[model samples]
Target: MIPSLGYAVLLIIGSFVLNLVVSKIRFNRKYKFPNVVPGWPIIGNMLDVPYPAGMWGVDMAKKYGEMFTLNIGGRRLVYLNSSRVVTELLEKRAAIYSSRPYRPMMSEIMSGGARIVLMGYTDKWRNQRKIMHSILNGKQSEKKFDDELLNFILGYTGTLGEYQFNPLKSPADVFTWLSRLPKPLQWWRPFGEKFCETHVAMFQKEYNILLDKMNKGIAKPCFAVDVLHGAAKKEFEISDVEKIYTWTSLIEAGSDTTRVAVLQMIAGAACYPGWARKARDLIDEVCGQNAERLPNLADRSRLPYISAVVKETLRWRPFLQSGVPHTLTQDDEYEGYKFPAGTEFSWNAYSIALNDKEYSDPLRFEPERFMNDDLKLPAKGHCRRICVGLNVGANNIWIAAACILYCFDIEQDPEHPIDQFNTLWEEPTKPPFKVRFTPRSQAHIDLIEREGNIALATDY
Candidate 1:
């Protein structure tokens, strides 16, 4: 019996070795990228990528040219560190490069395969994308809601923040095989179940609240109202869960990123008061010295400097620094390199936006860089999978930044100096540093009160 057990062990070890050898041979033949980050046997660069994935990719890009690869547990992660490669593959060859990689933990368990952000390229995803475009496409700036609903929106946003920063319960998310254990042995199961329940409850509550308002004929013409009132008539096969999550997804997409962009702008304002004052002057010229009214969407074309400031804010510290990973659906080649189907591609927005080759002074907060037509802002995403809420989010940021600069002079707290690069927060999306928003003057204060009262008093 002992000898038989020994032989069984030997056979298992031999099979493992053979499988590794075969995988290596196939990988070498398929992937011709010269700059592969070295890694340990079998594990293959799992430990090479550091936290804050974006900055690490930028460093690697500098060391390994425009494109590089990291083999993580035999899975190839191709990092496109420049805009040119990202556009070429994700845009020009979008037919094969537009799908999303499978995320079992986040999508399957926690979301029950309903999260639109991580959904693969399928008919369902396409239909959901259509719904998103229908709601988020046109002029969303004109739509207005009362302050009470805005407060509820804030509460909903806070709930999302709480869930986002919850501590990780399972390390097996990356190694999906571990997530497939028997029900009782799956350590992450309870957490994922709880997340799903909480997510559903929150989304359903918000949707119902909006739906109630809509039924009463008191709901404003917003994304939620549109979705609840059947905005996408052509989009069939969308389950109730999908519709609920879709509502939350649009908010999720716009909320954190938009908040970060606005905070970054405030940080920039505090850091460089001159530019803030310059933009403020431009705003003043557009609005008035006394601030007769707050900056509106109509003033967007007139406020070129404010537009430049928004452009610079987005470029300098992009919302999706590491970027959403796009999975290739078929075997493909780029620049004499071959990649097989299922290879995951991530464009480093951090690297591309800050690339010295692209930006003259990439590190500096230079809004003037965007003033000229020669310099174009870095692309957020490309092709069919680009952010559906791009227009709404951009308009939000522009109007928010314009209003903040118009209302107050942002000043950094001397006690806790602002570190624009300090991502070490319980939730990195929330601003790490505090700043004071000193009213530009009493007239500005009065204007805020007057407009806010008008907004609050206006019927839905």
Candidate 2:
């Protein structure tokens, strides 16, 4: 009977707490934004946000205007939806905006504080920024023949076997510069090849070769090579573990990201045929009928609309579903809310991108929305370790998009109607990579040779 009394008392207390949370959530009846009340101890309605984060920002902004506080595991996270507010906190107050939030797990297993992308504002960060600035800033990024080499290596080496199995009549079937490989891994399927095996094998071989040459001091300095060399020559005084960490960070800060950007551009073209056609028409006007001479960096001004389309593609489907979670190194105040230092925060860009106030006809796939100078959107930079690879990313997208626009007539399969397309709310996680770029015409061959060949003339 005594134990029963104790259990009943505890149950009563738990019920009372649950009721209190529910009331607080619905306390202000007029306001609402997917806010969920808390459950038992230490747990809030964290799972309420939509998955793949589709309409993520728009929904939140609609429910909670300029500012809304989220209770995540007892830590309060404030989401700033207004552009002006964001500019104020993340840009104007550079002193406060620059410090990075702690990422214990990633810091432990991965880069710690070496790479520019995730590193915080610190002495080491300043050093990384200095090196990064030298490596990637301003006109210096015009590292003549450097990107051209990477483009070809990515083209020739990355997709060689696939071309062999699925032979291409295109003139691009010419370069052969790869390193060694495992005996069994190099073998291809007699029929439909397991492409990943070949991709891994060949890529591993070439990457190893590049690594070996880099280590031997015999090869021309690639991006990674040059940066790491800077680190060494500068006597970074880092551990061997950190060297491996640096290399891994460099790869993360570079590779797959650029690839994904291009892939999204392709996927968007395929899904929205009208936009692609519009871009192609613009390209034809400036670049001429012969799709053979791909647009270079020089053509950006002449073909502003094409540039608009590229920007639209990025805006439509950003790769990451959310802004990387940001942690505060120092406490700050916003409005009247006192947010302590070491707090975690993030803006749901997906939600912001689709927000009605920020964009008109937000759901419509219209590049024209960004046509006028009055309303255009480039990634507004932040002080807290802002994106370091903007030029690399932009150049890659511009060049790749220019190439695709010049040569391909991307169209959705009529058999697979619009309804059949995946109506995902959030971008899928590690989504299976699938795409199709139908070659437009024979002239595309000439263009590849004209632009690609010149760039690839002497291994970049």
Candidate 3:
């Protein structure tokens, strides 16, 4: 009887091994593509992919050419290292390439499928996207908040990296069935639950506060007020819960990205003071040398050089190296290459932006590269899934950069030399580096104080 039991266990193990071999064979036959990166069997390329995939992708592109594929735990991903292919697959074929990749940890477990960025292309996602567009599609109002905002941003970065880059490092990430185990046994479940609770409470509190202010007829004309009571609320069909997450999602999308962009702008000025001087000269020509007024959105069209600086900063150092992943909804072919449905894809922002084919002398911080282009830098993204808040974020960065350049002469602090390439895995995206921000002139100092008092009075 004991021998019979042992034989039964051996048979179970053999069947499982057989199934795995068959699945691996099918996976290989199904995804016969070019420039496939070498990876392990069954596990595929999870261990091979690294952090800051942007740089790694650039290196891979140099070796493998423009398009390459990496299979991570049976799931294949195609990385577009050139803007040409990105435009072809993501833009020209937007109907199928607009959906997000499967992220069991980020989308379902942590966000409960409510995070707009990670949501799949579905009717609910469409409705939520509409709500986000209507509310956050305009110029952002300047509002101040405390450091608590950092917690959410940092938490999101950690959570996003889990599934965005090399997913399936944890088996449970791919085989979500493990999530069904008893809560006590599931080690990852509690953290996700806690994060969701805190995230919802923090945003919902702000939502409730805005609702109260609206009831008192004193709510400001902002995204929240617009969505809660303005005509947009009536136009879109979304629950109060969806409404709350939608606006917060905009904050999640914009806040940290805008911060990193402004920092990079300052870093650019420090590294290349000549361009900063040029930008200030242009600002002075438009706004006035005696600080008659601060640069505003109206002056944007006239300040082409400043606009160029903004573009150069982003191109030189893209904030999210791996622009969010997109998934194919159906089988498709591109240039004689077949992509099966459920194939995940992403653009190596670092690679595309710095490719010698796209930008000459790519390492240099030269705003002149964009000077001849249109002054008005519009944020018309690839396709249907175009960044809803990109325009607003860009404008915010533009104004902030204009104001900084107008008010101060940024210099690299000799005590602590700035490394523009230095970055952290956590929030603030760029690590804190000291830079000297000396006021350009006495007039600039006076202008700063005057504007400060005016904004303070307006807030009160």
Candidate 4:
């Protein structure tokens, strides 16, 4: 018995060694990808990537150049660190790179495969994208939608001081892996399940309200109305659960991302008073001192300086440091490097946006750098998978920034000095300093009061 056991142990060890050798040979034969060193066998570069997943990629790019590969467990992730590679592959070759990776946590467990954001490249995703386009693209997004969105934003920000945590944050990436475990072993299962239930209930409530209004001929031409109307006409198929997830996802996307951008803009205003002064001066130039009304979407073109500020704000600290990962549907090659099918790709937005080659003094908050028309903002991401609410979100930011800058002189609170550099990755609720928003003048206060009342009263 002892001899037989020893032989079995040797056989198992031999098999393991043979598998490792085969894996190495296959990896070497197919691709000469860089950044494969210092990784464990099988697991590969899982430990190499640091927490938050953004800063590590930036550091890796500095060492590995524009493109590099990190094998997380058995999955290969291709990191694109510059605009050149991102544009060439994600934009030019979007047809193959736009598909989402299969994430059991985000898709199957939390959202039950109904969330459009995590859905893989399929007929369902295509159909959902079409619906989103119809509602948020082009003429469908007009002044009414902008006004409604702005109102929602203002209402949320007005209570920022009262909140202990940011309610708008997307589910953390760690949950995506933890959710793969059995329910009994997944500690976050209850919290995630409750979170999903709460959001779904809220979405259902909103959908029902919109449906009632539609029946009464009082519905506005918003996303809910468009989606429900489409469903009524049988133009497409969508389950009740999907409708809830779809509308909620849109709300989360449209609101949460814009919230982060606006919050970052506020931080910028507080940290860099010179830029704030420039923006205010430009706004005053366009609207005239003590103007009759707050800045509106119509004034966007005239306030070029403020526009530059917006562009710089986005480029300096993009809300999503790592843009959503895309999966390759088939084996492909780029720049002599082979990418196997199912290889995941991610654009390191933080690295690309802050690339020294692209932006001079990339860390500095310089709005004028964008004024030369040399730097392009990657705030809305790129290619076919670009954010669906790009137009609406941009308009929202423009209006909010213009109005806020026009009314208030933002400054860092003396009680709490914000470490602008360190706060880039901080949660919204835990901003390093509380910003003081003092009205520039009584006229500014009056204008804000008048506009605020009107904005509150306006029905979308």
Candidate 5:
């Protein structure tokens, strides 16, 4: 009887091993990909894919060249590590690469697939993107959140370096199966739910107020106004919950990412005083030291150095480190490797932005690299799925950096020198550091106060 039991156990083990081998073989046969990293049986690179994928992705790119594949629990992820590859796939082949990957935990369960950022390439996503574009693209975007309003909001909210909703964490957590656990068992689940609920409530409240203002024929020209008007005209059908998510997602994108860029600029200024001096000198030359006013959008063209600073800040430490992942809708091939349909592609922005081939001394925070040409900012993403708030975000960073540099000289505090490198992992913030913000002159201080008062009084 004991012999028979032992034989039964052995047979069961043998069958499991056979299943794993068969599964792996089937996957390989279906998807003829390149630089495939072998993973554990059945799971397929689940354990191999690192946490904080952006940092890991950079190392992988160096080792595996521009493109590589990782199988995470049967899901195929293709990492595009070079600007050429990202532009080729995400931009050039946008039709097939614009869809978002399916995430049951964050999208369906946590967010009800209502978040615009997480929505797949569908009619809903297209319509939502259209609404966002109308509000935040082209010349219209400049009016929506002008420099003054943006500065006021940023200061009022004190959102800089504050931990808002982290979109990156959800994807990694779900991919690792942690988000699949029961709420009671998952520590982050409860907080995530609460955060979503709070935002939903805020959006609902704001939507109702905006709708009422629209009824009164006194609504402001904003995302909420556009969405509400569209629904009234039957341009699209969106539920209250979906609308809430859409508007909130826009706010999250516009606000949090820009805030991070500005903070990084400040950190850069403190770390490299010489560059900061150059920026200040440029701002003074353009805006005029005795102009008795802070720099605004009108002066943007004249301040090329400020633009370069903004570009460098974005490239140096992109807020969305990996950019948004795009899922392929059809099977595609690049450089002789076949990528199966449903394969999700992530642009390793960290790798591409810091590519030594693209930028000399890639790690150095040099604004001069972007001075001569219109270098693509991966922080805004790429292709048909590029960020709708690109123009607004750029303008915000440019004006904010100009104003800050014009008003004060930022230097590292003698008491608390910050470890800037270690702070890169903070999602959108540098480590806590004290910086001396000495006014360039009393005239500068007076100018800032006068302009700030005007900004506060003016409503967007």
Candidate 6:
């Protein structure tokens, strides 16, 4: 009886203290704007969230309207839906609003602020952005990379898409697969996923040696050239050590995102057979099924369906589900909900892009859905800070798409439709290998083999 009484007394005291603490965390009208939403104790209303799934955010948005306040893990969350609110924060009021709510784990482990994606608006952020723009901006990426194109043709090109993918492969087989990757990917052959620590180790060695080669004119400068040559302007006034960190960030962003995009392309091609055929037909008309050279940017207009395929690929599986999350810089209130400063708000790109209301048939792989007039581009501020490599990414994707169609017909043969597109996401079609691109005929095989037979000149 004494023990029971003691427990009861403690519980009352604890409740009192919790109430006091909650009361102390003020959300007052004097400082904050019109606050609308309610938060629960401790975990807040955010405890209701269903996680590990991207659709939850959109469902919440519809329920709570475009803007709402949520409390998760003792922090306030302000969700901005629709185009207007996002624009107000990111673009119109850009400076005060652009800070990322750095996660405890990502900040601690990530190297040298090697995360420009998480960078708040600051001078260092400016430097990093400046450097990126200089290297890949406007005509430079095309001109510089194009100049090196011929050499790679006579040599080999490396791209992110695996020549082939399937479940359960040996590590040795993976490397061999990489070495003999098809076409444009062969051009980018040396680059591979850094998920393999060994791959990164090898990459670091190759990078240094390649830099030396560029200096000696033994090879050409792509990314390294602009950075080393100091074309990055005023923002790049830093030591070589600092530059390495910046370069590392650039490499991480550029490589991983594009790889995911390319993977999505392969998956979509198999699932959307009609789109695939249209793409091939366009390729046939433009390249004549026996073109001397691979498709480049100049050939894009002649091939509309193939271009659509590439565009749809980007929209289908954007590289990131969420951008680096943001934290409110000040205690702001709106719509009768007080959003305390330092609240976490991450933009959900996946949810926004695949929205049923926004997209006609969100689940289906229909490229024509994009051809709709209003749905042509993303709503404003929705994807604030557009992809820096937009043109290059597009160019590379289109050219590669055309080249592949010209040389091969991608379809699932002797396999059920279920094998091509994994709907439930468990086992997920062995990541893109559920679909395959068989060479259309012997002539197609001969041409690809003939063009792809060129020796890779590894100066290093």
Candidate topping TM-score:
3
Q: Taking the tens digit of each residue's C-alpha lDDT, what string does model 1 give over 1-460? A: 9999999999999999999899989978767874888888767877676545557767788898888887766668888887788778888888888888776666777877888877889887888888888777666534532222333344445433333222132334456677677889877678778878877886787778877887787777666667655645643557788888777777766766777788778888888788999888889998999989899879977887887887788877776556667889988877799888988888777788778887887877888977776333323322123577777777788889999999998888889777766453224435577888799999999999998899668665
Q: Candidates 3 and 5: which is better by lDDT?
A: 3
Provide the clashing-pair count of each candidate structure: 0, 10, 0, 0, 0, 18
lDDT-based ranking, best first?
A: 3, 1, 5, 4, 2, 6
TM-score of each: 0.88, 0.68, 0.88, 0.84, 0.82, 0.70
CA RMSD of all predictions: 3.6, 12.2, 3.4, 4.9, 4.7, 11.0
In model 5, the clashing pairs are none
lDDT scores in order: 0.73, 0.55, 0.74, 0.70, 0.71, 0.54
lDDT of 1 at 65: 80
- The candidate maximizing lDDT is 3
lDDT of 2 by residue, 352-433 (tens): 5566677786655567776777322345321122566666666667777887877887766666533212243222233333
Residue 134 lDDT, candidate 4, scale 0-100 = 73
Task: List, residue by residue over 15-96, the lDDT tens digit for candidate 4.
Answer: 9999989998997898666455457775576556543455666777888888877766667778888887888888889999
What's model 6's TM-score?
0.70
| lDDT per residue as tens, model 6, 162-258 | 2111101222222224435454555332222322233335345655775778767876656655666673464357555445545554454444455
Q: Tell me which residue pairs clash in candidate 2.
A: 52-426, 53-426, 54-425, 56-351, 57-351, 57-352, 58-351, 101-327, 292-447, 331-341
Error of 2 at 162 (Å): 29
Candidate no. 1 TM-score: 0.88
lDDT of 5 at 326: 77
Model 2 scores a TM of 0.68
Stretches off by above 4 angstroms in model 4 are 1-13, 40-44, 47-53, 144-191, 372-385, 424-428, 458-460
Better of 3 and 5 by TM-score: 3
